[model samples]
Target: MSDTLWWQHGVVYQIYPRSFQDSNGDGIGDLEGIRRRLDHLCWLGVDAVWISPVFPSPMADFGYDIADYRGIDPIFGTIEDFDRLLAEAHARGLKVILDFVPNHTSDRHPWFLESRTSRESPYRDWYIWHDPAPGGGPPNNWLANFGGSGWEFDAPTGQYYFHSFLKVQPDLNWRNPAVCRAMYDALRFWLDRGVDGFRVDVIWLLVKDDRFRDNPPNPAWQPHEASINRLLQVYSADRPETLEVVEEMRAVLDEYEERVLIGEIYLPLERLMAYYGRDMKGAQLPFNFQLIFTAWNAAAIARIVAEYEAALPPGGWPNWVLGNHDQKRIASRVGRGGARLAAMLLLTLRGTPTLYYGDELGLENVAIPPDRAQDPWERNEPGLGLGRDPARTPMPWDAGENAGFTTGRPWLPLNEDRAERNVASLSADPDSLPHLYRHLIALRRGHAALSTGDYVSVATEGEVLAFERRRGGVRLLVALNFAQSPARLALPGDVAGADLLLSTQPGRDTAPVTAEWQLGPEEGVVLALR
Candidate 1:
């Protein structure tokens, strides 16, 4: 085996800045806060930290709608603070990845402000702008990902500007060479500052249909779903031209050494594979969310893993994500017991894995009252249960007031069970979820088989999913029980017997196994084959 790159074998930990920690008593997480809490990540054994957007913004989308690409937001901290955080993180051998929002900018951004001034403005074409349709309505039937028409009418200019998300955030015209140059320059600014990589936001939406055609209506549209789902995003997103744009972005990153580019594309597995580019010149990792979207069952998960592995390009690498700032927490999705099993599956998988903040503590989504809902999508479409505040609540460091997240009132409420489901409380318990994660991470780091081995599916019976990771003589078997009842996993005849290395169950003995292994409900185990 060749020497593995850090991103290929390392685990990535995502930090949602606003909820991670608050060091200034400002009731919000900032750069200084992340700097102070770096030790927690070190202790947890994550290789890299991918922080959400920290650029200057109007807080419209809680930092996603960036107004200034180069400057740090005052709420987060100054440029000096970010430099310090980056320097300290590097010193601790932690790779830092920033969120790059290239699709759109805040409506208040200077580019948008100048673009909206008039039709004749030099910057007018910097964004997607067009004259109103014949009936004085939106140019097409495209709908924003958030809600309503993708086009927002600018009364002064007598034209409608297209936005893939909120009307306040206008999509940049990547077709415009100037816009591409400017965005590329913004990337170089961070690369020059020594950031390791970027998790690009809405990367597939960077380009759109050149003709501005109406997206076809979805045949399976339902009123219960978000308004954007009413129509297929054919014309508004995932255009063929988008791949070329991805290649260009990759070229920018290639200018730097060993810097990674991770695109956030929410397409099906087949479509997602194309983002790897013709010769693996596109994104280094195109954020695989299969684990998050797949049915939480043995058969379903096994099928997805097989299909994804088969679909990878010759030189392409794979990655997995269980939870993120946008989705429901894994504990809430699969109960506490299953979370431990899921953690094992993630760490033992063939490729890279990203662990969301608070997942190690088995943190579930907190219920956010209507008055406390901060997501613009939830505010615009009330009662649809689309709010993300529940998943984005502040981290529970301890059982103190505000769960040790803040001395002031928390921007969002903490998990109701924070008293018991917190780092301080759980870290002391050897059987806690955090300990499970630490052990699994250490195991992956220490063994070449677990970290960079080839994967082979193992035959299994009932609710048990089994696979083998082998690098030459080092062979390890992983068996997981997806059901709530006990299941027996039959080993292959080629494997004479196995020795238990680790088990999700707290007190399970690491004894030798012969023929078949019995697995308790929601239990998962790693075995060393004899």
Candidate 2:
């Protein structure tokens, strides 16, 4: 990679605070917990840590529903704890990115409380508010992302307020200049505290249809799908006006030098590009969830990669994510064998890659029993198998009780295989996923072709995905077998034997390869073209 920008050349690791580690044995992860784990990330070879929200909140929707813009929740740690984390992270040459929730605040927030108290409240205009219809119902037909109506009637104010997810999270009116100023100040607050950047939550939902028009119905929505998908959401999400909101947010970020901004967006490739803003003034990277939802097939993944690469603005950097706090784990989505292939795909790609916590060890989703289910999304849609608790389970640090996450009863149950799949377990195994991840990371660090190379898809036999990563005079070939059955892939006719640099299979030598390579089931490798 060209050593121009750190973010451009680095891989990001995402940590869900409540599940990363528990320093005080409170059964919940805190800033101190994260600080203690800095060495782990350093060894993992990630350049930055993007932490989810740790702000003061009522836990209505975990930290996403924020009650305070500038303070940390007691369940986590204080501002001082966060500052110490930033200090230690920087000491290890790791950039820290905090989560910024700009779309809404908890109902318990002072601004929301005041706004809900009376129609004349000064902050009433700060949040989206609308009068009931002629029959005294919700202002519009918008549906909450979690479930039910997006509007919640506040009897005291004799009106309804908007929420995109949970009612407790009242959507802020970006149109309100006052709200914009306040949110911008929040960005400055963290920047002043030495955070490298922010991962803005749900940025595309910042603006809505000003006319308060009802969204159209989704004709193709399946009955088994999440209730929120019942509508087309034309008036509620991915609004064109949101691009201006992104520009404004970028302006606030511009106040600080060299600070990156990452936006959480889930729009299609075409619509997702707009978050870059009119003149490339938007977020440095709009978090790409393509890998999270894309079908785990060679052809499907190849198309997504090609399409996404083609869709980028002239200067926009690309990013890829396999799993996150809100989605199914990659290991669970694709089996253990597939995860290795995924790692090869993720680390060798052209842009930055964000690794979710515990993914290095191939942590699969831990099943949460009925009594243990904690995710609001799943709680909102019981029995539909939609809860996120499975993915957000506590990280398994070691083979100790409670997975060394907490001395007390963990906030969530340890996965069944923690003793075998933890950092300590896999880090020692030469062929383990964690070891493979470390090797891939270190290799990418030393090779421009693997880190920032121009990707060219290579034709291969069935279930075999081969691509060439080229930079300067270096060309590296990456081949992956998507299935468990062996597959024979024919290398390019113009190319001769290659020097094998690394392979998912254990103890594989960096040797010469022939025109045809037999790919072991779910095997992948990086080759230095000779």
Candidate 3:
């Protein structure tokens, strides 16, 4: 255990700043608010906190469209405020991970502003700029992830700039040596400030096809899907050159001590494995989002876990994500019962686990009215159910006004059941989801087998998914029931009986089991095999 890295065995908790807590009562969460809530994280037993971007931005894509790589947004407090938050988090033995958006910057950034002024501007080549096509349209047929063409025409420079996401976010030219130097400097700035590491945003999109070729059309595209999916994005992202960029970033992190680099990549498992780089020199943890996108059933989950375990590069680590700011809450995706089981599955699995801010309390997505919508994707493409506001809503801290997240008006509405689902109410109940999360985390930390053991898939009948985690002589068994009715699980002949260590259901029968065990609906249990 002394040789293991913190990220390898510890949990990473993601905090969406604006929705976390509002200290100044500006209807938005700030640095001080996060510092104030360090106690909550310590109580939850997470080892690290990964905060979304708080860099200065025009709010075009919230904080994702960074205006200044080195400055904190005034809305999120200044540089000094960030320092205080970092110090506080460190004092509590919790690592702080910043969201580094290296792929693009706000169109209003000084670099972009200077680049758009003239073709010969020293910074002109800092971004992806191309001359208009012979047909006088975008350089190619590439489509933006938000909508429309991926190229934004610049009237002053007579060129089209590429933006994989939004027009306000101009893609950086990672091919340019100068861009790499500057971004690396930005990384050093935070590292020097004693921050732990970064969760690089859209890391796969850092480099693009130098030819700027048109992406092939997606044959599986349906009208119901977002327009961006119309193309296969063959040339727009995940280019071969991207790995070089990732390797360069990894080199920067290597310059620091024990710092981790987590890449946010949304690719298929085969392609995603490459992000680990040769000998795991790339992202220490290329985020595993399979659980977020997979069907919440015993068979589907079991298959995915097995596939992911098999796909790991030699000595490469794996991670799991059940919910995030970008996705619907796990509680809403699976029912409350299943959310509890999912928690058990996440913490007990091998490798790291990243927990979204409010999921521990079983918080569901709040319904945002059409008029209150804030996500640019939802605004740019209305009625498509593409909005993320529901998932990014304020965290419910208490039953008081704004659910104790803010004294002023909350930027987004709270869950309709916040009165009962908040931390204050939930923490008081030992059977609450929050307590279940705490217990699971504690159990994982207390046992080496649960944290760093080898995973072995266990075959089970009906809707129960079972597995064994073994480290030397210690073996732990985990069984989860995905159905609404009781499910029976037969222990393998290798183990005749075991003592129950913990269960998702409160007050569940903990008597030692023989060769078989019965699991309640949506229940999961961890056992120390005899």
lDDT tens digits by residue: candidate 2, 1-530: 44547788898999999999999978999899999989999988999999999999999888999999899999998999998999999999999998899999999999988888888889999999999998879988999999999999988778999999998899999989998888888889888888888899999888999999999999999989999999998999888878887888888778887788899998888888888877789888998899888888888888898899899999898888888888889989998889999999999988899999988988888888889888888889887888888888899989989988999988888889888878888778887888889999999899988788788888746788889999888989999989899888677777777888999988776558888778789999888886
Model 1 lDDT at residue 120: 88
What is residue 275's positional error in candidate 2, in angstroms? 1.0
Candidate 1 residue-wise lDDT, 280-309, digit = tens: 999999999999988999889899999999
Better of 2 and 3 by lDDT: 3
What does the lDDT come to for candidate 3?
Answer: 0.92
The Cα local distance difference test for each model comes to: 0.92, 0.89, 0.92
Candidate 1 ranges with C-alpha deviation above 4 Å = none
Taking all chains together, the TM-score of candidate 2 against the true structure is 0.98
- How many backbone clashes are present in model 3? 0
